[model samples]
Target: MHFGIRFYLLASLLIGAATATLYFFKGHLYSRAEPLPLEKLVLATPRIPFSSLVILAKHNNLFAKHGLEVQLEITATGKEALEMTLAGKADIAAVATLPLAYIVTRSAQPRILAVIAKSNYEHSVVARRDRGISQPADLQDKTIGFLPGTSAQFYLEALLTNANLARNKVHMKSITIQDSQSALLSGDVDAVALFAPWDKRAAQALGESGIVFAPSLHTTHWTLTSNQNFPITRPRVAEKLLLALLDALTLIGENHEASLDILAQEMEMSRADLDESWEQYTFDVQLPQALITTLERELLWIRSHGNVPSGELTPVAPLPDFLDYLSFSALQSVKPSAVRITR
Candidate 1:
């Protein structure tokens, strides 16, 4: 073969190899198409048992299924969670009805989206044996630490009412949830109104010496709320969020055993412990009529506490339907049955 022919053949081979390499890389580029645009949301969680639906949603990628990326900000209490939402740090929050009631009266901007879970046995007034505080009545004249501005106050009030003790009769010390247990064990207070984990730990520590009285006679719901701006600016996102939560509730209802496993991990409690307390709660999707009645009753108590001006809101017989705060348009569009809260 001629030298020029050999060189030409070699050049042709090199060009073909380069062409094949380019095509290979081009195929890879197509395979790695642009990632889907995920809308981001900041959700404030109070880390309560009633918040298990939110926990399940977060853990199981339920939000992702709805094209959302939620950043969970674990707050100590629902009031704090709402504070984060107000401060522009969080878009949505899981809050107790009492705290939500307190804020909703003051600010006309926020709205309740949905109820995650409702529990009657989540909170209690724990008294120390050393203080001779054997019952809720013993809390009279006794200094008690409470997480003020949260459901702790309401729980305390309910317990006192049941015991027929006047609110002014007892002294209240403002205590954060983080310090509630230590404050009790260290004798800083005679008793404390605490929620789960703290409530469990306090009872366990006090053993036979303590009296644990659960004050929530009706229901304690961890409601999903928005900062008003979120629902107004991102209605679709809000709708999707509601849908995801409903889906989470469905999962818990249909596969209770699996839901328990998820709750055990999410609540950081033993399965047996959850089982014992399971009957106290009704974990399902419904805009219960009780929510309206409860809110109406608590709104009075909330007003009595009165850091807010009462005249700001006209005292009315029946407030707007609780559903007014909720946008079921999403639910209506997705599955009309989900919005069939009344029927």
Candidate 2:
């Protein structure tokens, strides 16, 4: 009986060892056999909320599965994406509709391919209590700092409109994003208009002495744009990219925690911090019906705000051609319901 028991024990040990070895080899083989992305695409993304979807798609293997190898180049803001596209550093860019008004006028315009997502609450104003900026009304005659773009100008205008304050009531200062926090902390500006991680970090840096004002411009749309000549040359790749983005958007909608995890990782924010403001962002992959109208209004604001000369840029005459810049065939091919552009 003792010899029989010993033989059984030894046999069980050998079987367990062999099974473990086979499982390890099988996993290794599968990893080694994983196919590479058929096409490499470099995407330009502002280190803002809009970057989340593309980053998620890349990290979750959605792009690779769709045969795309995506490399994300971090930009200062959506405006920088357009510059990157024009300079040939990137194939696709994430640009805001407000900024597109100015960009569409460039001799070689960056073609807006699709709307990746829309968010009303992406930007915010963080003020220090020491500056006597406790309320919107208190902002009267106060100095404010904004990032280097019409989009930042857009945020400031919306805030002024909401407070019923005239443009002259608030002194505006243009500051680089990297220097904004220090500017605010040092009282170089009474208050600062910022977005996402920067605004959130500013609030945290001030602790109980900070006031975060969210005067959202509900008409804001985050869009995917391409270089002046990319989509026309490579329509099929652009289509595949749109399909992948649609998939990524679906994942973001259906799996909130998973998407948030990816955003937090890329944005370098703690999960808890991301959750605080994540709910405010709207994730959808539809060409908004109001996109053109919003751009028109944004163009007016841009002109009046003097970010660009109104006479030099004519959004009206070029508006129709700008609409043509969007290619909807790829979107319709993958998901019919998402094609909501009227005209």
Candidate 3:
């Protein structure tokens, strides 16, 4: 009877131990799982110089680190991507300032979250070897192809106006980047406004014939626009995204050579072109006072000049909208070691 009792006790002990082990492992597995507030975010991007972050985020798994599952969709135009956010099809969009400004003017009030990339007026009006274009003024009476209704178009127009060329003097064709190269080479268009990799490629293809005319003024803002309601509805998600973007922006500035290499791979451009492009780009994360002033001035100019209808130039409301959108709290929470606020 004692032997049978001993055997029962041994069996019970083993069963108990197994149950305890299972319970401990189950807790561990739960701990390893993603946090309760995980989010799935969709970000829209256009093919341009500022697309570095989109490329890096996926490759480096930065989003996953923050419990975010991100989907990046490359759209035909920045305007269309911005529209996706407005229509509730996208969670965030990395695009130019003009379209966001236009959307803001229309009363949708998409908030500017961060400045992704800024070019130092290096954008040029390039022409084919046969076009014989020398300056912005030469663009007059010539068919110039650009992304119409984009910041590039607006800036190019401003450049032409400053150079004594009127809008009526030039024939404008709305073209995409893929087609701009062929259009200029085939004599279908006289000139195209190209940035970075395209600029280098155009220069090589047309040789001395490719004339580059720098825009008269600088575009200091390449910004991100997001739906206001998203932040309100999903504050955690918005905060996480903004934090990740700022982190990415800072990385780009600190390690430009590496950043350019990443951008080159993403755009499928030669490193030499990427280097040339990097020289013209200013990757700044902080919204400087000068940049703010320039943006405000741009809004005023766009209104006064009728570049966009006056109703479309309505002042950016919820000053704190920008403030909240850039809140670094989530980033701070995730990686406090990365951010150093120096006095």
Overall lDDT per candidate, in order of appearance: 0.77, 0.78, 0.68
* C-alpha lDDT of candidate 1 relative to the true structure: 0.77
What's the true lDDT of residue 330 in model 3?
Answer: 39
TM-score of 1: 0.81
The clash numbers for all candidates, in the given order, read 0, 0, 0
| Highest lDDT scorer | 2
- Residue pairs with clashing backbones, model 2: none
TM-score of each: 0.81, 0.83, 0.76
Deviation in angstroms for 71 in model 1? 1.1
Residue 177 Cα positional deviation in candidate 1, in Å, after optimal superposition = 0.7
Candidate 3 deviates by what RMSD? Answer: 5.9
Q: Which pairs of residues collide in candidate 3?
A: none
